[model samples]
Target chain A: MDLLSNLSLGFATAASPENLLFCLIGVILGTLIGVLPGIGATATIAMLLPITFQLEPVSSLIMLAGIYYGAQYGGSTTAILINMPGESSSAVTAIDGYQMARRGKAGTALAVAALGSFFAGTVATLLVALFAPPLTAIALKFGAAEYFSLMLLGLVSAIALAHGSILKALAMVVLGLILGLVGTDIYTGAPRFTFGITEYADGLSFVALAVGIFGIAEILRNLEGDQDRTVLGTSLGGLLPSRADLKRMVAPMLRGTAVGSILGILPGGGAVLAAFASYTIEKRLSDHPEEFGQGAIAGVAGPESANNAGAQTSFIPLLTLGIPANPVMALMVGAMIIQGIVPGPNVASEQPELFWGIIASMWIGNLMLVVLNLPLIGLWVKLLKVPYHVLFPVIMAFCSIGVYSVNSNVFDLYAVAFFGLMGYVLLKLRCEPAPLLLGFVLGPMLEENLRRAMILGRGDPTIFVARPISLTLLLLTLAVLVVMFLPSIRKKREEVFVEAD
Target chain B: MKNITVDWTDAMAGLIFILFGLLFGVQSLGLEIGTAFRMGPGYFPLVLSGILLVLGGLIVFSAIHDRGGEGVGKMAWRGLFFILPAPIFFGLTVRGLGFVPAIFLTTLVAALASFKMRPLWALVLAGAVTVFATLVFSYGLGLPFRRFGPWLEF
Candidate 1:
């Protein structure tokens, strides 16, 4: 009855005309970004964060959440039609989905992806509703030391999961942490790294950094070697799948959902891992394993289902402990701050409507995607024909406008250019920008918690080990680092990233 | 002579990290570094800087040890030349020329980065973008922006 009441309350908030309208707008915009290969949801969300400032906090969050998962649906479309995943999570979907398109089963592939995603999304939503309350209760008891260790575990795992040299990822994280220390210190109002610029007294702008590294940097990378994206010229064969096709998809969809839901709770890009895991599992489990790379029904169904499930469950951490599971979640943290809501365990209790409204909106958003996308597929195909040359200029103009509107600061614009250059250099050096953004977001909080914990423990380094929860978290962090450094695991990790590239 | 080869990408990356570490480390020393019991603004940053330095050195060592690695790929010099400055141009001119002119010029600059874009087409694209942006952001959303700043006065 309690769960039912909570559900009704959530539905009540999400079903409002105004909230519904914003959610629709968000899903549409997200799908647009998803169809376009040049820009990403992270950048789109960053650009829109300023615009969202005018709406109710709950509405803004609902719209933002809509965009995140809507992209998952949109990404699979491109994967099937163009062999290019607009989002990284759909990279695996491209493998078999594109092959299906070539064989005139594009409609089947698209249908399977959509249906699987919807089924998986429903299950994940229930899981979130079931599990979030319990996790928030547990999070309420965490002290500063425990929080510090938890954040340390997060940072370490992020580096471990990141592509390229672990040393470089570690360096990037430390570099991010240093950049975060630019403003005046909280404990003692002394400016740290302002370099005599008062414009940076409140620290570097998060929006500027995000837009630069993700938005402008992506533009420059694409421009390096401009190439064409192929869209399937044939009309969609059929929108509805045959009964046999649906029957074949049943087991993989279930299995993918289960796998994705669990893996998504882990830190460091779990949705991406979930999709890849689902593909590998389907290949192994398939009766005709040879059909995998050549176009297997399970191939498109499983990963899309798993990826959606994973994307939904990743919100569990941000909603519970205020820790972002990936870069997108980090932006949510920034968004929450902008909306005057400090994201933490208290958010659930203090603003139940805001919390539950977002959860409810996800379901509404998923339903909308399923309803709108199949009919809109033809429209998206037409959109894919738009050349990239004209697009980047508009993107550049938008990035400038979005970054400027944050605080009307001219210096932030300068920072955008500076970070864009840095981001490009980092890309050429084969560094993953995701981990740095994660580190940047977590840096100030990590430092603050460490100092607070140190003071609480009277300057004793053993304080971390003295507490049970803190000690356990530190041990987990150590284990992740050790496993990453192991010769066999390191080799395996390299292979995974190579396959991804 | 013994053969000497380096992965320039890794070497450059390592060098950037080193420079960043040294810069922050030296800067941290200028502030008060309290004892472990109480961290000053400088203590945590100094410690992080040390980790960065060690990590950078390890990266450089690995890069030197790596053999037959792919060299740094072709740089996007043209893209960098045009794209990076577009935002700076906007920042400089948005206050003077106002929203319409600033955004138009910024879009024009960015469109030039691609080799496929012709000058006239770029101009048309920039103009279209400016009109749309002015209509949506200025009129529809009602962001407080001057259509024309004082610098445009006759």
Candidate 2:
């Protein structure tokens, strides 16, 4: 009954006319960019973060939540049609979905992906409503030691999940933590790394870093290819799946949702990891195992459902602990801070409407995607034909205006350029940017907690091991590092990443 | 000397991290490095810089000896030439030239990154972006940007 009432309040908040309009705009815009190659949800939201500052806290957050999941929906469409996933989470979907498109079953593949995502989204929303309250209660009891250890675990897990050499990923995370400490120190008011620039006293613009790393770096990578994408030019035959196809999909969707809900809760893993895990499981379980790479219906359905569920449930950590599980969640933390609402457990109690509104908006946004996108498939396909040269310039122009409008500071624009170059260089070295962003967001909080805990314990240094929760988290962090370095697991990890790539 | 293999990509990446580590480490040492109970601003960063330096060294050591040398691909030379400067140009000129001209020029510079783009198409794209950005950001949202700056005065 308590859960019922909470959800009702959430629905009431999300269903209002103005909120509905903003949610709709967010989903549409999210899809539009998600359907484009080389622009991920992280960059699109980063570019749009400045615009949302003008809106209400609840509305801005609702729209942002909508963009995050809406991109998941649109990502599958490109995976099926062009053999190029517009978002990385949908990468595995391209394996089978594109094959289906090539065989003139594009419509069936798209429909299956949409329906599976809708079902998973529905289940994940309920799970979030059910689990978030208890998690928040648990998080509220945490102290500085527990918090510090938890963030360390998160950073280490992030490095574990990243592609290529774990050493490089660890290096990126430390670099981000250092970069994050660039502004004035909170305890002493002394500038750490501002290099005598007054404009940077408030710290480097998060929007600039995100847009530069994900946005501009991506553009340069795309430019290296300069090759045109081969869009499936055949007219889609039927949007409905056959009865046999439906029967094959039901079990995978269920299993995928289950796998996704669990993995999505862990720090540093989300939709991409969930989808890959789901696909691998489905492939193993299939009676016709060889059909996986050649376009099995389950291959498309399972990962699509898993990724959508993972995308929705990833919000659990953000809403409950105020800690971001991924880069997109990091941006949410940034948004919350900018709106003068500190992220974490208190948000659920102090601002019930804002908290629940985002929860309810996830389902509503998913429903809109299913209803709106299937019919608008033609338009997205047409958009795939637009020249790349025209698109990047427009995106660049918007990135400039958006970064400048945040504080009306021209210096942020320059920061965008500097970070953009750095991002490109990092990308050249095959480094993943996701962990770096997560580290940047968690850095200040990590330092604050470490200092506070040390002070609280009178510099004993054993307090981290003395406390049960902190010890457990530190143990988990150590376990992850040990596993990453194990030769067998390292080989397996490289194989999985190679297949995904 | 028969098999002196070094993954250049990993080596370069390691060197970049080392440079950043040394930069932050030396700077943090300049600030106060107090004790644990009552820490200074530099204490945390200084420790992190040390960790980073150690990590960088490990990466370089691994890079020098690794056999699976996945060579780095072609660099985006043309993109780097044009795209990196677009925002810098916008930042420098937005105050003096006003929002309209600044945005137009910025977009124009970005378009030049692609060899496939023609001059007339780039001009038309710039004009469209200027008008649209002006309407939406300036007129619609009512952001406080001057239509024309003082430098534009005759």
Candidate 3:
């Protein structure tokens, strides 16, 4: 009941001309970057974060959130138009969506994707409205030990999700944890790893790390191929799906939304998991299973809807519990902190306008994406025809400038280049960067909580299990690890790990 | 064949972790901070290093015993050449020329590393990149930029 009233206040705030304008701009920019291969919403938001330093908190968050879900919608566009997935979440869409495009049903595929995403976004936003308060209340009961255990579970989950060798993934996680320890210790006045550099005193910049790892690295990886080109074809048909097509899509969309909403709440499994899980479910439930990889409309609709829904709802963990479920959410948390808003259980009560306004703006942004993307479909398709010779240099230059502008420091430019090289090496070695990023973002928070919990318990490790929520999470982590190591489950786990790409 | 890649990667990572652990352990010798609490400034890192050492040793043992796959070679050189040099080039260029020039040079070097274009095409590509960057970062946003000459001043 309070949510409805709060939502009304949010509407009033979001309806303002300034917020709406920024939201529109965010969606447009987000879509453009999402349509471009190798640049994801996470990197785009990281690059754009510094610009929002001057904006009001609500407006800044609205815009950042818009970029997040907008990228989700836009990723589907590229996945369908070409075999290339613009984001990891869109990889599932590309499997079936590209097939549909090849079969000359590109228009139908795009239309279904857009509509399904719109529907899922609306539903997910409602779920966030309804479930967030209760979740926050539940989270409020968690002690330091519980928080530490939850983060431990999150780290374990990230390691499990990572592709390639588990040892490499754990190594990256350890490296991330070490990097997170670079800044001044919160409890102690002493510096840990500043190395006497003033910039290092504040610890490693999130923007620098994200842009370097995801953005610049992606550019390097794309460039490694001698002919990095996207497939393009000339075909224009009706942009709207028929009544029959809508009927066919309804069940999958609902199922996808359900899957997405549930998985989106889980730390370390956001839109990417949602999309993959949705596609798998759709395939399992399909009447014509063979048509799945051959451009089935349901294949695109289900996963696209799930991906967008998951992207929107993934904000729940960050907003309610101050736990970022993914890198994008971590960046959103950075944005919130930049705006001077402490993200936690009291956020809604403390800043109703900012909270509700951001939620309301998500719906507006989704509406804008649908309205804006339909016309821009043709434009993006045309852009896809641009030769790699012209496109890649522009992308690399933009990435360098974006990385440099954060502090107006040339050191960050070097950092971006350095991490870009590391990213490429990681790709060659089949190491997944997503888990590394998750570790980096979560590492400090995890360590802080772990230390605090131990201090409170006078160095007793049993405190982690003595607390109810902490015990549950620790047990869950143990269960997941045990299951993953089981012979039968281990085989399936390997398949899932490889299937992520 | 199934375990060869995993075994090698594990052993390498384990060795690196152990080295880091020993280094940190050595460094902690000079610290005078009291360890009354579970987490002194040195406490977490020390514990982490120890854990890393243990994990690393376990991985090396696992790799040695791994019989599921054939051993592969050390690493791929083409990947090394393409991926490792961009950062070194960026470090070399950044201080003297400032952010913009450093970016231009980095992109140019990266393009060369890509090895997808001829020398003439690479120069053209670099020039085009510089122009595009100037338009976006300098002209469009009006960010401060250093020019090559006083004659170009507005």
Candidate 4:
């Protein structure tokens, strides 16, 4: 009854005429960017961060949330039509989805992806409503030691979850931490790495770093290849799934929701991990495992559901504890900060309407995506036909404007260029920027808590071990590290990533 | 198998990290290094640099043990040339030339990065983007910037 009443309050806040209009606008724009390859929710959110300053906090949040899950829906559309993934999470969908398109079952695959995602979004919204209260309660009890240990766990899990060399990921994390320390010290009046620049006193601009790395670097990477994209014809066969398809989809969708709901709660786990993990789980459980990469309906159904579900539930940590589980959630933390809302344990008790309204808006956004995207699949496909040459300049122009608007400082634009080049160099070195981003987001928190915990323990450094919750988190971090190094499990993890790639 | 050599890219990446670590460590030496209970500005950074050095060492060592599969794929030299400069041009010109002309010039420069771009088409594209951006951002969003700058004053 308490949860029901809270949800009703959420609905009341979210269902206002203004909120609904913004939500619709948000989903449509989200789908537009998501349908366009090389642009992602992370970049889109970064670009739109300044606009949120103009609206009511609740409506702005609802719109951003719409963009997040709306991208998840639109990503699968491009995956099915073109062999290219519009978003990284939807890369898994492209394998079987593209195959289905080639075989004249594109309409059925799109329908399955849409329906499955809708079902998963509904379940995950309820899960968020159920779990957030309890998680916040646990978060309230966390001390400096527990917070430090939890961050360690988060960093380790990010490395364990990321593809490629763990050492490189570790290096990236350390580098990010160093870069984050460029500002003036929190405790002392001394500057750490400002190099006498006045703008460096506030550390790097998050929008610049994000737009440069994810947005600008990605555009550069995409431009490297020739523009030879072939779409699986405009004829989207029958949009309805057969009775057999429906029956097969049922178990996978339910299982995907379960897996996504659980994993999405973890610090390093989010929509991408949930999708890939669910796809692997479904393949293992399916009797026709061989059909997985060859247009199997279950292949499209499961991962799509899992990614949507995970996207919804990933809001849990951010909303409750102010800990971002992934880069997208990290951007959300930036948004929250921009709104003058301190993202932490007290948010639920402090801002009940804002908290629940976001949850309710997610459900509404999901419904809007299904309604708006199904008929507009053709439109998205047409968008894909727009060549990279024209599209990229427009993207770059917006990026410039977005970066400039952040602080209205020309210095930030320079930072964007610096990071864009740095990001490109990192990409050349075969390093993934995702884990580095998470590390950057969590860096200041980790350092502050580490110092605080040590001080509290009177420099003994055993306070982390003495506290039960802290010890447990540290142990989990250790376990993740050990498991990542294990040859057998390491091989399987590599295989999973390779398959998705 | 083809003669396996040290993974040069991995080695170089590791070297770059180690260099960064050393630089940070040396820089932190100038700052106050207080006790663990009461860390100064330098304490956390020094420790992080130490860890980075160790990680960088490990990566370099691992590079020696592996068969070099591929070097950094073909450098997006053209992309680097255009994309990196486009933003810099915008930053330099925005205050002097104003948002519209600055955006226009930036787009034109960026469009030239693509070999397929025709001069006429690029000009039209730039004009179209500038007008649309002016309408949306300058007018609709009211992002206070002059449509024409002091430099245009005759």
Task: Give the winner by TM-score.
Answer: 2
DockQ of the candidate models in sequence: 0.87, 0.87, 0.34, 0.76
Arrange candidates by TM-score, descending: 2, 1, 4, 3
Candidate 2 Cα outliers beyond 4 Å, as residue runs: B66-68
Model 2, C-alpha of B50: deviation from truth (Å): 0.6
Q: How far is candidate 4 from the true structure (C-alpha RMSD, Å)?
A: 1.8
The C-alpha stretches of model 4 lying farther than 4 A from their native spots are: B1-4
lDDT (10s digit) by residue, model 4, range A57-96 = 8988888898777766777888888877876688889989
Interface RMSD of 4: 1.1
Fraction of the reference Cα-Cα interface contacts (below 8 Å) that each candidate reproduces: 0.89, 0.82, 0.32, 0.72
| Each prediction's RMSD to truth | 1.4, 1.2, 3.6, 1.8
Ranking, lDDT, top scorer first: 2, 1, 4, 3
Worst window of 10 by summed lDDT in candidate 3 chain A: A221-230
| Model 1 chain B worst lDDT window (10 residues) | B65-74
For candidate 1, what is the lDDT? 0.87
Tens digits of per-residue lDDT, candidate 3, A191-310, equal 776557776777777666777777766665555464756565558577888888899899999999989888888877668778889999999999999998998888988998898888
lDDT-superior candidate, 1 or 3: 1
lDDT of 2 by residue, A1-501 (tens): 989888889999999999999899888888887888767778778877887887899999988887776666667788888888876789999999999998999999999999999999999999999999999999999999999999999889888778889999999999999989999999999988999999999999888998898899989999998778888889876989999999999999999998888888888867888999999999999999999989899999999999888888889999998888888899999899888998989999999998898999999999999899889988888988998999999989989998998898998998999999999999999888988899888989999999999999998889999999999999999999999999999999999888878
Model 3 score (lDDT)? 0.74
Comparison by lDDT, 2 against 4, better one: 2
Preferred candidate (lDDT higher): 2 or 3: 2
